[model samples]
Target chain A: MKRILSIMGFVFAMGSITSLLIIGMDALTFERILANEQALFQSKVLDAFDVPYTTATINEVFIQNVEAIELDVNGETVTVYRDPKTGRISMEISGGGVWGPIIGVLTLEPDFVTIANVAILQQEETPGLGGRITEPAYLAKYIGVVFNPDVVVTKNIPSADNEVDAITGATGTSTRFQIILNDTHAKLFPLLQALEN
Target chain B: MNRFWKRLQYTKWFNISKDGIFKENPIVVAVLGICSALAVTNRVENAIAMGLAVMFVVTASSLVVSAIRNFIPSRVRMITYMVIISSFVILVQMFLEAFFPVIAASLGAYLGLIVTNCIVMGRAEAFAVKNPLKYTFFDGVANSLGYMWILIAVAFFREILAFGTLLNFRVMPDTWVNWTVMALAPGGFFVLALIIWGVREWAKYFDVAAE
Candidate 1:
């Protein structure tokens, strides 16, 4: 009994100390991490709305042009950014990619059916292959695109209202990304309509 | 007395440092931490960031593991080391996310995976647990340096071929066709293999010349 107690005590002591260290570290960086996340989210939102912002002026632009809100949809609380002037809304959205979740901000046009723009906030795809999804050249195709009916990503040249030229080497990411786009848009369009009404 | 001091510092500490950096380089020779070496070596900026992150994790974990060596039970020692190493890795991830979000994003899952990096665990088990704090510190620095240089070199060649750029600055001419394979997994494999071969050849020649 004494031997078991000693072992248990050792385990508890070690576990608690490790937990405290992690907690202390997390507490120290919590605020800064939150700010960084906010900055990245705002930058993506601005990009999606096609608002011009430099490193020095992004926060100002976001504050001036965007009103932010948090809402629950399908048991997930998502932050959405609205451009009060344009009535276009940007939402934090994510879906699975090849290795992990691909996270991004999506902004819709004033009509709420067409995509104004999109900018990828985070991804874990192959660095030089699927990772091109985050590159500007690929994302540029999303600007002012109409995604209603069905959004498509294809390897061939995009020639339709919902067509986007897939990244040359990243077919998997493009296909999965299309799925995410269609799903998120389908899920949110009605909720957005309810909010507008 | 001075000769003895020279042998202790130079023949000992200097050799340890040199071995880690060149002779028994962690990446090329030991080949212990190959996962991050390949994963993050696609870009020079990412390689540097990863190297620095590993250096911090290995050094901090080694320090703590060494400090607690005497008290930890032999059976639970591995688990304890893991806990220490992971704590440092999480701390690094948090710091990078807070201060260097660009790097944090680019690195992504690999940053959190640093806890699994064998270099930290290997050093703890082989050196830090048995050595005094000073020597353990030296060992940590040496191994990280070994790991850093190899990663940087791999990134250098890969970036130049893959993107025709180094550090994202255009270096290749407009007419240059980027070798598509150079930016992918095959490129990493090919480049790392070439490096290992080149290092072995150089060492062989150096040894022959000395003889």
Candidate 2:
């Protein structure tokens, strides 16, 4: 009975001490971490819009150049950013990849059909394979691709306007990415068109 | 002077340091914590950051464990170590996320996964629980440095071959074509394997049982 009580007491003490340490750390860093995340998201939006800004000026540049439009689709609030000068629209698109969710910012040209640029915000796909989605070189291929009906990630030479070359060896990521892009685009494109009109 | 040197060699802390750094290195000899070793060693900067992070975690956790060793019950020892180690890992994660967001992002889930690195738990159970605080601190620092040096060595070769650069510096000539394979996982495996072989051979460490 004494040993069991001691074990229980030890466990309780250990849990309390560790929880206190983690809580203290969280309290100290919570604000800065949130700010960093906000800055990162804002910078990615700036990148999608091709706005010139250094790390120090991300918030200011973002405020001056980009306009955020919140639209209610299917009872969900979806916020998209637009570049005032070019009328290009950028939105966050995320879906399951082979390993984890792949989140990226997709910017479309003024016509709301052609891809202007793409920047991956987060991904857990296998590095150097499906992870190539985050590479600027690979993302550059998405530029000029159209979404007339839907975007197709193809292995062969892209022959159609909506077809883009997939990552060389990541067919799974490619297919899943295709579904994500088309799904998000299908949902948001109509609202963007309505806003433009 | 020679007598003092001999006495130092016979001391507990010195032996612990020597064993942790060379004889029982976390990576080379014991072969603990290979996942992060391979994942982050592709870039010199990444290796440096990971090494520093691991160094802080191992040292801090071991010190805490050693200090509180007497109070912990045997049945709950493992759980205690895990809680302590994970709390430190969370602190490191939050610090990096707040101050060094770029490195935090580059490390991705691996930063949080430091809780899973065998070295942290292994040291707590094996050394810290039985040892005094001072000896444990030495062991922790020495072992983490052992891990760090190996990571840096692997990154040295990898960064050069893979990107034709060292720490993003243009080290290779303009004519040098980057070895695309060197940037991939297989390259990490090959380099790590060669390093393990080289270090083991140099240290003359052989497992007689394996033979």
Candidate 3:
């Protein structure tokens, strides 16, 4: 019993010291990590506006061209990025992938009906397969697509304005992405509409 | 103390350190921790990042574990080493996320998996627990370099064949077509096998010449 207690004490002390060290590391890097996440999201938002910014200039350009405001969409608070000149609105989206979470940012044209651009901010879709959803080639296909009936992912070649090609060998992820993109759009579009009126 | 330090530098310890890089290399010769070796070697940059992360964890964990060797109970020693190693892995993860966000993203779950890497646990159990701190430090360095060199070699061929690039910079002509399999898991296996064969043969020939 005494030996066990000593072993337990040693283990506890070691764990505590490790936790404290990790806490110190976390505290040191917390701000930079937060800034990095914000910068990534902001850049994706800016991509919708077709605005270019390097890592060094992301904040400056975000300040120059984007107005970020929070809105209550249903019971949830959503961040909305507005382009003052074009009246474009950008919103973030998140949903489940086959293996992990998928996140993206999308922007509507000034009219709020036409998609200006959609960029994936983060995703865990299979790389070279489902992961291609974030590829510029794939994301670019969504540009000029209409969101009225929600964007459709087609395995066949996309011809109609609302349809886009599905990633080859990743039909499940493609279909899941379609649902996430549409559902997020449906959920937020009405709330975004409330902002206009 | 001075004689011991001098002997530590110039004697059998030197060969022990050298052994990890070639004769008992963790990756090619001994083949410990092959999962990450196969997973991250598709890209040269990812391999470099993983190598560095492993080096940090192994070196730091070994040092701490060796320093505290006497205090740990024999039955709970594995658990203690794990805790120490994981703490370092978390530190590396946080540091990467803070400073090198892009690489961290590409590395994904593999970074966290460093805690389970056999090379680290093997060294902590087989070496660090019994060795002095100074020798344990050298062992960590040697073993990490052994692991790193093999990972880099596999990554080099895999990247060049799979993407026609090195570190994402295109070296092949614009008309060059890539081999997709090289970007996947099987390619890593084939590359690893060939490297092991080549390294073994070379080492064998060198040994025979010396004898």
Per-model RMSD to reference:
4.2, 1.9, 4.2
lDDT of each residue in B60-102, candidate 2, tens digit only = 9999999988898878889889888988999999999999999
Local accuracy of candidate 3 as per-residue lDDT tens digits, A41-104: 9888887787889989999999999998787866678788999988898888788899988888
What's the lDDT for all of these models?
A: 0.85, 0.91, 0.89
Q: Tens-digit lDDT track for model 3 on B22-126?
A: 888997777799989999999999999999999999999999999999999998999999999999999999999999999998888899999999999999999
The candidate scoring highest on DockQ is 2
Index of the highest-lDDT prediction: 2
- Candidate 3: how large is its RMSD? 4.2
- Give the chain B TM-score achieved by candidate 3: 0.90
Q: How many backbone clashes does candidate 2 have?
A: 0
Summed over model 3, clashes come to: 0
- The C-alpha TM-scores of every prediction are 0.84, 0.94, 0.89
| Ranked candidates, highest lDDT first | 2, 3, 1
Q: What DockQ does predicted model 2 obtain?
A: 0.89
Model 1 steric clash total: 0
Looking at chain B only, the TM-scores across the models are 0.90, 0.96, 0.90
Which pairs clash inside model 1? none
Candidate 2 DockQ category? high
- Candidates 1 and 3, the one with greater TM-score: 3
Order the candidate numbers by TM-score, best to worst: 2, 3, 1
Candidate 1 runs further than 4 Å off: A1-5, A67-88, A95-100, A124-132, A135-137, A140-145, A152-160, A163-179, A187-197, B1-10, B172-175, B205-211
Query: What ranking emerges by DockQ with the best candidate at the front?
Result: 2, 3, 1
